[model samples]
Target: MAFDGIVVASLASELKHKLLNGRISKIAQPEADELLLTVKSTECQYRLSISADASLPLVYLTSKNKPSPMTAPNFCMLLRKHISGGRIVDIWQPGLERIIHFTIEHLDELGDLCRKDLIVEIMGKHSNIIFCNDQGKIIDSIKHVSAQMSSVREVLPGREYFIPDTMQKVDPLTVTSEEFAAHLTGKPMPLAKAIYTSFTGISPVTAEEICSLAGMDSSVPAQEYSADILLHLYTQFEIYLSAIKEDTFSPGIYFDGKEPKEFSALPLSHFVNYTRVEYDSVSEVLETYYSTRSLITRIRQKSVDLRHVVQTGLERNRKKYDLQLRQLKDTENREKFKVYGELINTYGYNLEEGAKTLECLNYYTNEMVSIPMDPLKTPQENSQRYFAKYNKQKRTFEALSVLCKETLDEITYLESIQTALDIALTEDDLAEIKEELTNSGYIRRKYTKKKVKIKNKPLHYISSDGYHMYVGKNNLQNEELTFHFAVGNDWWFHAKQAPGSHVIVKTHGDELPDRTFEEAARLAAYYSSMRGSDKVEIDYVEKKQVKKPNGGKPGFVVYYTNYSMVIDSDISNIEELE
Candidate 1:
């Protein structure tokens, strides 16, 4: 998500409207690198949060206030001493850069009026909150970057406050067409990169949006753009920068499936494929995007251990299955041994007591066969030896065939669990998966004998034709959906021959519309392993036709007959129910 200059500009506009002429009533530093200020405006009280965290630099108007430490830090105390009752005169951004300057007027110790600038730079690792004199010379900062840390500029006391790494960018708000053309022709980078690199406050997302608006390919070099294309791109740039200049902004977040993907100050038109969640306030958008994205990332990290276990189990069982298949193939010749024993017993009476070999016609194939015998043994003894060899091979085949089937079944079950983990979204979803693993013997049950009640339920969606579609989130859910929830004549869909969610389309004793069938097939394809494939073959059958073998693994089913279709995995048009 980009918290770029446009967003900062919008935020600056909002602050100027709300905090200008307001008094700084209190200052608190709850975190080592964070500051929470309570501003008292004529209208109401506002809590402004500004963080200079190296990992997450943020500036937002929050309703919640954090508890401060018993002893404030040096920076916090300094801010309190100087700006405790200062009146905010102006709030502004510096030429589309990710920086905000707050000008304050207050009385000094001798009652002399003085002015200071509280500058907050939102650059990633080099972010800092520096208190500067009216001349823009640094007084003190939350973070002081010495000459040893950065050669470009020193941010210590008395040093000049200049934005690093953005000194050369031409402000998009002020660039002329000639200037734009010069910069466009100067860079031999991709269209998107050139736009962002040449202009201040333009992020890669905004650059791509500009390219999309101009109908130019973002990946192609700017040099490859024709003169007319360049003109068109410059027109689109003006359209966007004009909005920022006019103080009109749209704050929103884009979502991929149900997960928050990115947020921006302006509508992200380039993300046509993702769902858009719009907000009236940029602060709200930022807070929601970061918090939701953080939770999704956290859940994925937590599932890594379970994923590793499933992957390792799948690999081991797959290898064992291959070996068992080879062993089963070896036993394919077991029937030949039994046939040889039969021929020997039938023709052995013609052999003399001292004969070393016997030749006879095999009745099974009407072909000649020879059996070698031990000269020291009688014909009856030789026949018994062949019979014993045949019986041993038959026993080996019987044992290995069962073992091979079990290994294959285990492999399939593990794969289904892996797919479930992929679509898992919450802690409860993961809890259900863990429970399934424990039941399937992949995970050992805890000795405490306490179980976490599973609240995770199947995905529910309504088809365009108004039919209900239920998708299993795990193998256990698949079993529950099919055996207990579904009934005869209800349609079931799965990604044919691939691991996927069990999609049951409820018929309710009525014929399902064609649109409903298509929607259910799309759901089946999207939640499966082949989700992003161009085409996924789906098998749809009546729930009654989908039968589970007794004692089979959860979600394991057999369908002797079914209807099939090839469909894409895009389910954006389908409406999902909570």
Candidate 2:
């Protein structure tokens, strides 16, 4: 679910409650698509994370720190100059249009109070972060859009900042009974589609929830409903809207067919009674769902190539093993053929020229060996029998040769895969490793067409300063968290070996004290499959040192000199993420 409007609205609400009247102590763009805002409230300090990546745009309060480029990007410097130490006056969402605007009041260079607007558009494929002056003139944006970049609107400096219009059919929260009745009277659309199309704030999930509350089939034809039924639905929808206004929301799951699949904050019982139902706050629902989904996506994408490489090796080994087994069988057949040939040659002349059978003295075993032949057999027939046995033995030798070569090749392939899996640190690397297994026939492909499960759980650790560190389980996750989730100046750690996950320590820009390093080391050890060894060799390198190898295996990298340590593999001291 690409950071839909509802999630943004929930986040904006949370931010407003926590950050209003708070001063922005620091601002940093640790990554091009991510922002970390340090807000100082009277009760506590808050680290607000905002990301504009289309797949997982989010605004959440976290306690984690991240690593950033040594030299701040021009954009980072610009934000620091303009908005640092600003007081957050308000957090506003534009009627669930996938946009959040932060109104900040700060002292200008002349020491005069000024207000600036920081707008974040959460719409997928069109998401952006723009900084505008009080006059609504965009000073700069995270992404520069010109007439050339977007024919629809130019987002460069000096342009007016305005929300782009999205055509919607109805106001879900304010639609009157008469208006809804008029819209649905002649339309023959599905109930879910009609509601979703009618309202700007209504997602498919919400639409289904409305249908559930009204006791109507979400898939039922809208035109088929009786006027009385329609009136009932409108009344129910009004009640649902009232619930939203009162903030009395519940989380529910949705299903396609029998599988309990998608999750939502609206009750989907009207459409299907999803067996796996859970209730959570609107904020909790967005945070948990998007966080897990983002993590899984990161792991799969980052590990894709590495998994492929490993799986390919595994497959080659399996084939080689099979071929060797076949050759072993053929070799046994050859030995039998050799014995047959020797017996025939020894008993050939002992019998009459046309003899059907003869017994020969076995010189080696001190026993009689019997040779049988065709009745009235000629010299040519006797010669043919000996030659056929000889040929069978020769064919066995050839099979053995091919088998030896294939076996060696397979061994080499298996070894490579093992090595790759050992060095895997990130979810991306794991994804590649898993893919390799699937491709090599080690694991069967999952039949469901939806996204594959990339990482089972995030790699977790406690830093020396008691900060939590998270490592991605696959490539996609690595990209998401490392580049999109982490803040600048936080220590980044990775195993020095091969393709691995990108480990991030959320430091909030404080210098990493020693305990953090040990915690990170433990994480590196546990995440690798070599988790049971007494001492596992780990290479601790800054995330900046880790460079993705070009066209290399997913999560594969080349790092310069890094700190090395041999740490005990026990991870009991580290806390696992829930």
lDDT of 2 by residue, 1-578 (tens): 33445555656766777889999998888888888889998889998877877666767777777787888888778889988999999998876677889999999999999999999887666778899999999999888888987877889999988875556456565677888987766467898888777766677777777788887998987888888999999988887667456655565444321223566544455443234445444445555566555565665566566556656666766776777777666655554445555666666655577677667776677787665667676544665775686687678678777767656645543554564455454555566556766655667788776876554455565654678798766554555665567755555665544334567888776677776677676666655555545576777655565666554433445667677877754555456566
> Whose TM-score is greatest here?
1
Taken over the whole model, the C-alpha lDDT of each candidate is 0.89, 0.68
- lDDT at 204 for candidate 2? 77
lDDT of 1: 0.89
Look at candidate 2 and tell me the lDDT of residue 235: 89
Model 2: residues >4 Å from true position, as ranges?
A: 184-188, 250-263, 266-287, 298-578
Instruction: Specify the poorest-scoring 10-residue window by lDDT in model 2.
Output: 252-261
